[model samples]
Target: MGWLLMIALAALVLLALWKVAGFGRLGLQLAGAALLLAMAGYAWQGRPALAGRPVPPPARLELPESAFAQTREAMLGAVDQASFWLRMADSYHQRGDTYSAAAILRSGIRAHPRDPDLWVGLGNALVVHADGMMTPAAELAFNRAAAIAPEHPGPKFFYGLALAQGGRFDEAERVWLALLARAPADAEWRPMVVERVQMIEQLRAMQRARPTR
Candidate 1:
């Protein structure tokens, strides 16, 4: 908004100079129109308002056309049926199609039990479906993947997420601390770990303040 205001002011000065150079009243009118448009655009952007209540940017959908496009491209030259199934599962996962994603990954796993990626995908799908139930199924799926590829971070992260979402904060804390220890000090997941730890502390404090049930 500030930049737009500067540009509009500059244009206004130029317009005034051109009008003074005998360009006629028509050039002045066009300059006035341009100034109004720039000012209107700046106002609509809502960054500098006298009222002090800035409007927020538009909310965007979680799943968008580009994610779908990527899925389409992934499917185009899939090496095998398993690859195609996995790509389709990824598309379903991106769209929050947990059941479909799990089913597809399960099929891929049944076809190729040795595929660590398939197991990891299945585990992630199960975690998504777990929501609040924290069912034994999700635990088993993650455990299976972790057992197959114990060094893989994907299963561990999902397991920690599942523990956190299930409200087992103590267990989640232990798991996340362990993950952070294994993960690099400057891992990209550091912020997420910090935030989750803060959330856990806040919730625990709230629980302590509540009356006994």
Candidate 2:
């Protein structure tokens, strides 16, 4: 679908150039067409990874299973509304297709750019795609989410998770500490964040104790 749209668009652009310019300065017109075609080719080459195979069969992804729903009430006000697409993305992540998961979230962002939850979802997927490493791209996603929804706890929590996964426990702890301080006492995700902070502390201690070979 995406490719076909791009091809159609390229043809339209070429046709418009032909009709408007009438091949006057034919070299420039041909160059424009060539550039459009090249772009289409590049998009097609990357389509497989960008729009990969179908995500895991649709299923209700639970909270504790992936920690995805931990901050559900805070993030999107609940799990069943616009967050349904987010759950689908999480399902892909659970099934080990982080690329597809990220792609789905990206599509969601394109339609709803201001939705911080989608940005956080993309960040989470990127973290998984990097094998628990928080790559720069993942960081950017988190930052975008945070910038868009400065008061939202989802971005901070997931950014911290990514840091912990990348073995940057101290950074993760700091992020989580700030989140905990601001998080409502009755918030459903507070306990989960506390649990993860404790886990990170323990992991940091162990890493410190392991003497270099």
Candidate 3:
């Protein structure tokens, strides 16, 4: 019964190719031969009687949005033209659509070229889109944000984050150290930076202690 169904399906496919796909006589013959060979191989090795098993979906890598949003608000302030665009991009980022998030940030940057927050957001989106690698464009975006607001913590903090994510721990440490040196004692985001720096130090120590191949 299973063999009959397979043959019928193959025949229907060949007929469709001949009629709808405009296969010539020679092409139809070649396709038929290929189908026969496939059937023979299946008969020898395929297991048609096995029960189907459900496959769990692969895990998705995503940003921690709540912590991210809080940090952004703390560093860049809570309201502005850039804030609207950042929120819109965050919605897309939360949905695992990093491309759209980056695109939206690009649009926002075009409209407000000197908005440091938007540039930082674009850098972040681009890094996430590239699966945590800090691409040249993302680096450019972070640099632009820093150039626009020399004193802003958002650019340096998030740039260091992208560096750390890409395993450039030394560079991340330098960037965060500079930020910490200038950051005020009572700044809301200072604690996060301190924690991240400590984490990076621990990671560096672990790497040093790892057994070499």
lDDT per residue as tens, model 1, 1-213? 677667778676766668667656687777667777876786687565456678897653354322222332222223355466767876776676668878998888888886655665565567666654457777777788788878755556667666776678788788877877887777655666667677888999998999996
Off by over 4 Å in 1: 1-87, 90-97, 209-213
In candidate 3, what are the lDDT values of residues 108-177, reduced to their tens digit? 9899998998999999889888988999999999999999989878899999988988888899999999
- Write down the lDDT of every candidate, Cα atoms only: 0.66, 0.78, 0.89
What digit string (tens of lDDT, one per residue) describes model 2 on residues 48-95? 555556769675333233555455556456644348678888777766
Model 1 scores a TM of 0.50
Most accurate candidate by TM-score: 3
TM-scores vs. true structure, each candidate:
0.50, 0.60, 0.66
Best first by TM-score, ranked: 3, 2, 1
Off by over 4 Å in 2: 1-65, 69-77, 184-186, 206-213
Off by over 4 Å in 3: 1-67, 208-213
Each candidate structure's count of clashing pairs: 0, 0, 0
lDDT of 3 at 138: 96
TM-score winner, 1 or 3: 3
